[model samples]
Target chain A: MQQIINFFIKNSTKLLFLLLLVISFGLIIQTHTFHQSSFISSANGVTGYVYENVNNFKEYMHLKTENDALVLENAYLKSIAYNNTSVKDSVEIKNLMPAERQEYSIIVAKVIRNTFNTKENYLTIKGGDKQGIQSDMGVINSNGVIGIIEKTSKNYSTVQSILNVKSKINAKIKGSNHFGTLQWDGKNTGYVNLSDIPRLAEIYKGDTIVTGGISKIFPENIPIGVIEKAYTNETSNYFTISVRLFNDMTNLGYIYVIKNKDIEEINQLEAETKDE
Target chain B: MNSVAFSNIARFIALLIAQILIFNNIDLFGFINPFPYILFIILFPTDNNKPIFYLASFTLGIIVDMFENSGGIHAAASLILAFARPSILKFSFGISYQYHNLNIIKKVTKDIFTSLEVFGYITISVVIHHIVLFGLEFFRFNFIWEILLRTILTTVTTLLTCILILYLIKPSKK
Candidate 1:
């Protein structure tokens, strides 16, 4: 026992270092596997508070650009609203019933913390489960898709940004049924890759890509990006296309969280079908 | 607190602010990021309390990791760097490293050779930190070339910045 105490006293520094290193490694493993390791994440209360203040200060610096974007979006929304009112009046004249009910609702939230310099990037927003946000809800800006909600605390949530290496979204070419998986190559922040596209799909350099909506997370036809380059794979018969995202992901501000109302029903029906 | 403890605390806050607010945002060429925060680990007094030093490094690393949203990679790398610091000092400063109190603001500002030795010490330490950080970040053997390229590029950038900051803080002869 004396010798053991002496040994520990002599090499206490090394032992402390080893212990801390192991803890760090454990943290990395936990975050990578479960992705629910929110205790040490930026969404934690203290860290979230610090990031919120910092981002608020930074947001003030970009208010002009943000205001300009808001103005354009407001104009577009007003035009759509005007057209809808006229259509509704004409439908009343013809004694026609209203169209189908809305299937998705949008929750506006502010990005309080964002990181684009890492391999597995995440964004922290100012809304959480308390604000009707849950994991797997789709997040989008006015321009295009941003990411999906990964985890949530009471007053804040973390988003697994589309720039992350683990991000994979279902996307298809606009005006056609050619669908593929959208993934980041960890090369460029502005671009992502669309793989598993059959070689016969008519793809062009400037074609638009939108969400496939095969899953219940997002509604149909949410815009994703534009194809920058398309080429056939050397080892496989599928075409791998490069898409330049419309949303400048690095400079995100206000974003919308999409909640599909029929998601639970759809999932239950799909599970029942699979059981058979 | 004594002047030593006060100055160390000040250094910690200054480095943390610079790392999180300034260096974290500077993504040069889309890949090169100079982490000057490793200077705190590199310049920490060797004869000081080892356990406290290790703890300080771990806390600094974890805070940086939280800000960047990189889960514990920086903490792991910072601990490794701090653990390896004594040997690095011995190698860079030779037997004379044992004689002089080689604190950067005091003894390192005395001569040209001493300043160069300090630069050498920082270069080695920063390179090791960056290699470990990028290696763990891109944890695949297939990305060995990328890891090497990033390590080299970021090492040069960080080393130059450290030397410049050191000079700005304490202008050495030559």
Candidate 2:
């Protein structure tokens, strides 16, 4: 009614501000870690669909670069399959006595948007649900592991970039067998920090880091990075080791997202054991 | 009800399309993502009711959310900027500047204080948006330092991109 209009006109700015503030705060709360509302994920779907197409076009632009990566990785993989058994032996060999080994299928896909500079860095891949791409598939470049697939639509998937704080990969030193978790400081592009390496172990600089194979997420022996610096912190028992990542995470064009065929089985077993 | 209002709406839709679809998806340098859709907010018709303006900004953010499928982070961030716009205006400019329906063109070219105030408002909003968006995305306080660095660098690039677009269009600044 005219009364409503008059009332609105009287305190329009204040009311509008309050309304927006409420909606925004609602969204923030809805998106907050404490509250896992379905709204944010649904909105991500809309945003995802739109970006999906745009990523398609932009990914096309990087076709040549991605093509180069695919070709190179293919050649290297082919050589490993045919000639280099010793190098490949360590990766394929499984330890029955140890934790479950995940068998992963690596598929080469183009990177559309690989934003490493941002705190919550994400990488978009050309493959998606149609390609059998699923969430939690490990993403890696030629030199090392990069990220994990967080979401999947029809023809595209978004990988939670290694730069993301939410992302972690179980990793360890190649020879020393010092196991730790690799996580980004959310700062540097090519550098991430290794946490939980026991202080008692004699750690050294320049040690090559590889996936720990502890969890069934990634296959063991996948290269992650090289230790740039190692120092024990007084505050914590874990040695804080800086890793200079082998893959140029910032310039990634094409990466192979590895799907571990055994993850479900292993997870099922783990869940059963934990429940017991 | 002038066609200019409709034209502005169309412009907003088009720019947003270009921004999320074209600009944001680009891996220009890995970490540097410069979203230019905020220009829509800076260019929104000021003749409408303030609450309606907030709704419009929220809708704009919803559109972005729909495409990114990131829940309501964009809407959340845009609404915050829209809410903060008035306070930013008051704080940056003197008491006199708040009273009049200032001319957008004159504010840009003739008034240096107006220009600075406008720029200042945008810079703060951009920073605030990134902080909230990234912070919520992580959903944790453990990576605070990484979040800070990313916010600062991305904000710098976004600010530069905003200024570049503004200078290019040279829209009558309000």
Candidate 3:
């Protein structure tokens, strides 16, 4: 027993380092696995509070630009509202009527902290469980698709920005049923790669891309980006296309968190099918 | 001794706040993030209380990770840096590192260390930190080029910023 004590005393510094290293690696695993229980995320209260105060101060600097964006968005929304026949012709009107029945609702939130330089970027916004924001909800600003919420505390949530290398979203070319997976290469902040797009689908450099909506997270046909480049690879038959995002992700301000009301129903039905 | 401990605590908090608020947001030349916060680990006393130094480094890394929303990559890198500090000091300071009271910042201000020794120390430390940080972040051998590019770019940026900070806050000669 004394020998073991002596061994520990002799190597305590190394032991302590190994112990801390193990804990840090465990945290990395937990965080990467998409588990919701991790404690060290920005969604936690103390960091969230600090970011909120900083955001409150920083918001003043961007007030003029923010107002200009709001006015532009308001004009666009008003144009849609005035064109009654055009609004009725859209797919959203069809979904709102009978079968789908308003499955998605938007909750307004302010971006408290945003980072895009890292390989895995995240945004902390000023709404959480208290504001009906939850994990895995789609987040977007007025311009276009932004990201998905990954964690939430009492008054804040952290979003897995589309710029993150780990981010994968279902996207489709506008006006066609062809679907692809949107992912970031951690290279340019303004671009994302859309893969698994079949070879036969017609595409152009400026063709618009929109959300596929196959998942319960985002509504269908929300604008994502325009194709910046596309080419077929020798290794695979599918085309790898580069998309330029509509939103200037580096300059985000306010955003909307989408809550899908039919998520529980869809998940239960899928689980039941899998079990069968 | 108490005042030394207190000043260390103050420096820790100050560097962390500066990192999370200003440095992280700088977005220099559009993507180079200067993480001078490792200065906490760099400037820590090289005397006794080795275990406390390791713990403090881990705590600083974890807190920075919390603010950045990166899972423990910062913690792992900072811990590695802290564990490797003694060898780094020995290599940079040569024979002078045998003295327990050797202070890099003080010695630099007092001209005990030539600018090359100080530069080498900061360069080695910052490069190691960035390599470990970006390596775990990319987490793929195929991204070795990306990792190397980022490591070099961020190291240069961080080294310049750290040296400037060292000059700004070097302790006065008694």
- Best candidate per TM-score, number? 3
Candidates sorted on TM-score, descending: 3, 1, 2
Local distance difference test values of all predictions, in order: 0.84, 0.71, 0.88
What is the C-alpha lDDT profile of model 3 across A91-165, one tens digit per residue? 454434565577888999999999988778899999999989989999998888999998998999999999987
lDDT for each residue of candidate 3 in B1-174, tens digit (9 for 90 to 100) = 797799899989999999998898888877788999998888887787889999999999999999988889999999999988888988988866856578655665455245788778878888888999988877789989988988998998898888778767766667
Candidate 1: tens digits of C-alpha lDDT, residues B47-164: 7588999999999999988877788889999999988888888888886765776664565434424567766777789989999999988777988988899999999999877777
Q: How many residue pairs collide in each prediction? A: 0, 17, 0
**TM-scores, each model vs. reference:** 0.89, 0.76, 0.93
Point out the worst 10-residue segment of candidate 2 chain A by lDDT. Answer: A34-43
Candidate 2 stretches greater than 4 Å from native:
A1-75, A82-102, B21-35, B62-73, B87-167, B170-174
Task: Report how far off residue A179 is in candidate 1 (Å).
Answer: 2.2
Assess candidate 2 and give its lDDT: 0.71
Best by lDDT: 3
What candidate 3 gets wrong by more than 4 Å, as runs, is A33-38, A85-100, B112-115, B171-174
> Candidate 1 or 2, higher TM-score?
1
Give the Å shift of residue A214 in candidate 2: 1.2
Worst window of 10 by summed lDDT in candidate 1 chain A: A92-101
Which 10 residues in a row give candidate 1 chain B its minimum summed lDDT?
A: B104-113
